[model samples]
Target chain A: MLDLNNIGQRYGKKQVLSDLTHRFESGVSVITGPSGVGKTTLLRLCASAERPSQGEVRWCGEVLSRTPRAFRAGLGYAPQRIDFPEDITGMDFLLHMAALKKIGLREAKSQGRALLDRLGLGRDADGRIRTYSGGMRRRLGLAQAFLGAPDILILDEPTAELDPQTAGHVNDLIFEKDAIVLMTTHLAESLSGRSFATLNIPMAQAD
Target chain B: MTLFFESLATHTRIQLSRHLRSPAIWILALAAPIAARFMLPEQGGDYSIMSINSAYLALDPATIGLQLGVIMAVILTPLAYIFLRAGPTRRQPWQADDLTPARRTAQMLGHWIADTVSLWVLMLVLGLAGVVISLFRLPLSDVRPIVTLLCLCLIAAPALAVIAGLRTIFSTRRGLRGAGGDVLFFFVWLALLLLSSAFFATRSAPPILDVFGFAAPLAGTTTERIESLVIFGPASSGDVLSLDAWSGVMSGDYLFSRLFWLVSVGVLVALFAQIYAPHKFKALRPEIVTTGPPSFSKEPVPLASANGSLISLFLSEIQLVLRPRIMIPVLLIVAAAGVVLPFRGMVGPALALLLTFPFSQQAARWRGMEMSKLSALTPLGSSAVFVRLVAMVVLSTALCLPSLVNITASGATDQMLDIVAIGLGLPLLLTALGYLTRSAVTGRLIALILWYGYLNI
Candidate 1:
């Protein structure tokens, strides 16, 4: 279980999130809000990629920042811009992610192959990442997230910049996974059939 | 600790790491003392040390150390200048966010100040040690000059660092940005830098030297020697300047000078705080930016299309070089140079170097056009690299067309040949070095070193 205890973030004077507190068990959660309500900030905070200015984020009853190695071990994050190192192959990047997540090379190879096949990017695995289309790059972002079977997956606009077919493929992957998933996207109504909770952050009231 | 202080510390540490990572700074910092050790022992280039406490005091370690401080300060300018470009203290600096502009600016300024001071102190310690330790042949008593020199350096370096740091930070403030402000900022910056280095520049009685109190620790000495000294080599054995003469805290004048600089530093700190905070700057306001379009459209381009060819990409690279924003100013500069000295036989290559900068700034783009999926299907192999390099040289040469015509009309074919070689080869060589080092700064620094050597030779 992961929980945020009154977390808040301000970049300069603009308060992005204020007194935001929430908890998530092992299930998919869709974060929705009007544009600029700090949906991405919330996901980033939960992922341990960003430290909230106020309050604390707890993972499995321990503080997230204090136990970073252990906390990040179970967390998978895909930011808005997946800056793929243009030089490396897709397969090599997945393997790099696998190593970063501390997975064994042999297991990483098999898991990498399985995940790529599941994401419909099996054919393009060996190709250089720079050659990948926008939709394909989005799939690779998902592919990296699933590398180590992370318990908490934080994806910021996963369905963004993707074709309908690619978007459908991403939705299937989300429903299929049993991990605690937090995603921010306006087109999430497509997943209406899935048993997922929605968190709507209102506009931050300025002082 | 509060998040504000924590953020300051965290950001400052990162900035320090970045400064330490610069190969130029590291090379110069370490080389300062070693260069001083060897260079100072044999000869005092322009002025000699008349008295050094005693005839046995073989070297005036204080002068060499002070000189080392100046050199180190000069070399530290690159890192200081780096802090001027952008704000620090961000996790994903992909795009500017809805944070208060002032907070980040303040943190960034703090980082620059901390980074500059840390680097200066480190260089001081290392350089001083290098000089003192390398002179192991001399007895501790003979090496007493090192102590006085180190103290002097410590005082001078702080003021120099503060001047450099504040100059960089203040240059970014509201009134001191843009083209006109750039010239003004640079002029003021250079003036302050010179004033801060007054220890070496001015050696006159009061009014002139006394006005620049900050440089006192470096040049605030009153040597009342018995002999009529030309400030030269090998004076009488009895001509020892007393310890009190060289002490950093001797006169009230030095104290007032040091106090003035310290107060000035505090005022700069307050000024930085005032300048970088949010609410005051419109650019740092919070706004929701749509991250591109909601939907994607795919338009496949055939490889045989005009826009898909390598030649088109090369032409596009040339167009990018001639874009009005970058090209107009450069053209004006070249035009002014021509007007100033229309008959100069060597203007062609100099003009070519000026024109090529815009293309070089568009780095990595020329190598492989940042193409869409359908067009970028083929790998941009070695051929594309050659095309990009040649395209830059050709375009640069085209910019130098008038100068080349001038040279041709003058019938100085030998000078024209030199122009061709430099114009065609220099950009290619520098860009290749940039590719090798994975840094444009490396390419720029190497070019600078090459030019310095060329000029000196």
Candidate 2:
């Protein structure tokens, strides 16, 4: 469970989120806002990647501040614009994430192979990442997030670059997972189910 | 086989294209050597030529091979990394399908081989030029051994590339800043210098010794004897047990030393290549957030209050520096050059200044980018933001101050100071100029050209 109290974040003088309180239980939740609203920033804050100016974020009754390795152990985050270490292969990357997550090498290898196979990237397992399509990269991102099977999954614009089929697949994957799924998206069609509670961010007024 | 060859050929061409695109790097790699060879005067007279030839002949083939190999390795290693990473960044042309680990490794190796071949070809051209020039001053027959030595050097080029590629893949730093390659090259060069000095010191050779005596395949009567003596130094003891074999000994005087190094390098290359796996798709994940929207209220947020976020922000900053994108190439280039350029002769100042120019621009741009991002969001005064940005820059510079100081103390204080001035001051000026001109690239270009002119003057 996640709780936000008095979450007031400002970009200079422009108040983005003002004294807002919210609670996120175990389920899929959608964070929606107009362009330039702090949807991405808010998601980042929850992922422990960003900090709120005047607020407290508590995870499971403890005030979460740092994105501790242990905390990150239970958290899987996917950014809107995905950037990866380009020199490593998709399989290698999964293996690295597995290692970071303290997964056994043998298990990691098998899991990596399985993940790639499941994502239909088995054929290109040995290929360099530079050759992957936008959709494929997005899928790869999803695959990595699922590697640890973390308790909380935060995906920002998860389906932005993906094809509709891939997006649907990702949505299905999110739905199937038992973890807390928090996603931010600009597209309305991407969110069809009420499985997620939406938080619409208002635009900043002109100074 | 055809498919392999076709893939290799296409990859090689792409690698070459990428290398050629960087005109500055291309000039440094190729033209610098050519220019050096032409500018330096050749040792004249038969004795000088013979002495130079003998020196060349006395050099272990493996040692020469390793030296040439290391050079080629340094040049090509970063290129391999860059080539591998080129796709997502869109810095170079790479097809989406080319992202497989095996294909990427094969492509990198092919490219390295191509680079090695090009380097050797250039060496050959230089060697031929040397031969033609030497023929006018001495009997060509006497310099045959030296020519053979040159051939040995050429043969060793591929080995160097392999070694370099392996280092780049496995080592934390790829290019010039890589400790493994740089340290190896350093010890090798030092050993050669010490050995040469010890040999001459024992013989009580004159300071104005003939240059040819040092060349490989010692020709003429006196130099041939010296060359043979040097070559036979290891074999003369008559006890084969005293000699180190390549397989048993890690280090020592023996024919095996060179062989051992080559084998080691080969093993390292194989290991690195095996471990190297290029991903086909990038995992889109935010690692950390460095800057957040600033507080607009007049009340100050205590440092202790936001300790967690502050720490996270600081760690993220450090992580940004550590990220492979920035760290890998920087380390590689620095490693290749080693502690300093060996031939710091006349062009040292110009080279140092030129190198420092980019560093300054990078620092300024980093600060500017952070400020721009922050300014876009909040109504916080630019002055406070600027102060914070400057503090960050200063802190970063402070961390690197030790290295800067060491560089300065190394008898290039003037050059070091000049570099710092240009590197830091120019960037600040450019950042300001960028705001006025509304064009960062234009500001940078003007600053770069101005600095270049200043250095030349």
Candidate 3:
């Protein structure tokens, strides 16, 4: 379980997320809002990628800040803007991420191949990310997030810039995961049949 | 023509706004004049028996102008390339305006104008600061110092225009874009400085080819102390001069030479831009086709046990640092220089010191990327950073090997230890400092300064 108690985030003089309290169990939680409405901020806060300006985040009663390394062990995140080091091949990047996640090389190779094959990037796995197109890079981002199948998943706009069919496959992968999933997205129709909770960030709070 | 002017105006505003907001620009603006003041202290101030500042302080207005001009020249010359490195036009958003040749010319002109305008503003601030410093250091009756400094600042406009034009051409040219180009420019600046110092020593008016316009102005000054000017040497003795009304700077020869170089460089940039404009941009290509997602098997592969490999992480870090293929040839050349140059004394060690610039920049970039969300979220966390540090140390050691081989063969444990310290220590220090400060330019600048010091030592 993940718990947020009155979390607030400010960048310079601008307040992005304020007094946001939320709880998550093992299920999909969609954060929906207009552009610049702090959905990404909320998701980033939950992933422990950024600390809240005020209040605390707890993962299973352990404060995230206190046990970030351990918390990261069970966390999987895909940011809204996917930025991969351009020089490394997709397979190499995943393998590196796998090593970070404590997956053995032998197992990582198999898992990376399977995931790449699933995402239609098997043909280009050995090519550098610099050569990969936007959609291909997006798929690579999703593949890494889904690498170890950690207990908590925080994905922002995972299906964005993807074809409808690819987006549906990504949605299925997200819904099928037996973990606490927190994500922000614009496509509501994609998640219509799935049982999930919605967190709406009002437009008024944005700068 | 209207559209061109409109585009130029729009780009000028955008670029100027960006310049105003950049912390680097602000830092340079405040630091340049302050550095100048420190370089030229109060005349006849108390100093140690061997100190040069006392002699530098005793310089006439022409020498002072030359010093100020050198300071500004070095700062502004590299700045043109550094700004390009930081903000590459290739990264700009694809706009419809880019398709029109007139608008493209306008955009390039706007960039040049913005650079010149900002540089002029900085020069004015530096001039005012110089005047303020003069008020404290000089008597009110001696305004030649003030006039000389201000006139140099004005003469600097033409010099800066040329520098900005060359920067535009450099940007447009292929194979002259990265650290290679920057390193080349540094040598070019050194050559110009040498030539200018030679002209000053000869007491001859530097012809229209004076890249740094100050050479001609200093040559035309009334003070016979021009021969005492040294390119990177400690201040030698020169007879102290009493206050005299110096009007040599207002001469037509100096003004015409500066104008001539400025117009030549400006025309070259315009012609080069027109010639290369057609081949500059490539059409966006379509991406590869995506296949349908794979069918998921009912029973999934079991999760792998939690046991990360530091070796893999280290290798990936090495790959990241070595990503730019140019570094491969550069490293080979550094090693060759170390081998070909005599291993005795400082020669080999000096070659090893050269590796610090490229490696530190690459390492800083690698560490800088750690702050990003993509890497920060990874479970390896600080362990990955540790692995990268080890990687840098290993690479630094490899760079030292050519120097190390000679020291090792000589049986001089002391020199071997010295090689190891420089090899493993400086790059690590520079890279860590760069990461802490989050500016590759800071690291590169510090490395070069330290490298210069090490060479002189």
Q: Best by DockQ, which number?
A: 3
lDDT of 1 by residue, B1-457 (tens): 3667776676566666665665646665676566555434443233334334333223344544543443444444433343333213212231242263425544655555665565465556655664665366345665655554554455455555555455445544545432233334344545655565554445443413332233444344544332232223554454334333245444565656655665566556646655552223222222212234332222221111111345544654454455445666766577446433542333543564454345444343322212211112122223445655777787666555666676677775566555565567667866685454333333443344344334332
**Which residue pairs clash within candidate 1?**
A11-B99, A11-B100, A12-B100, A13-B100, B102-B276, B102-B277, B102-B278
Each prediction's TM-score versus the true structure: 0.51, 0.37, 0.83
**Model 3 Cα lDDT, one tens digit per residue, B1-457:** 7787898898878777777777767786788678557655665444211122224434445445545665566555556445544532323443444465555566667767777677777776666666666656666665465665756564577767766675666566555543554555656666766676676556664556567765565455445554353333343453353322234456676667767776777677767767543333321232233355434333343455557677767776666667556767767676656554544445544554556555555555434343355667777756766676788788767766776666666665666655655666766776676566544544564566456545654
What DockQ does model 3 achieve?
0.45
Give lDDT tens digits, candidate 2, residues B372-425. Answer: 332222112223224433533443344334445546558655555444544355
Candidate 1 docks with a DockQ of 0.03
What C-alpha lDDT do the candidate models reach, one value each?
0.56, 0.47, 0.66
What C-alpha lDDT, on a 0 to 100 scale, does residue B102 get in candidate 3? 52
**Chain B vs. true chain B: TM-score per candidate:** 0.61, 0.39, 0.76
Best by lDDT: 3
Q: How close is candidate 1 to the true structure, as a TM-score?
A: 0.51
What's model 2's TM-score? 0.37
Calculate candidate 1's fnat.
Answer: 0.00
Prediction RMSDs, each to the true structure:
15.1, 19.6, 4.6
> Candidate 2, residues A1-207: lDDT per residue as tens digits?
888887877778887776768888888888876776777778877877667888888888877774344456577777665555444467765654454444555565666666666555666665546556676677677666666457888888878876665566567667767878888876668667646777666664212
Candidate 3 chain B — worst ten consecutive residues by lDDT sum? B46-55
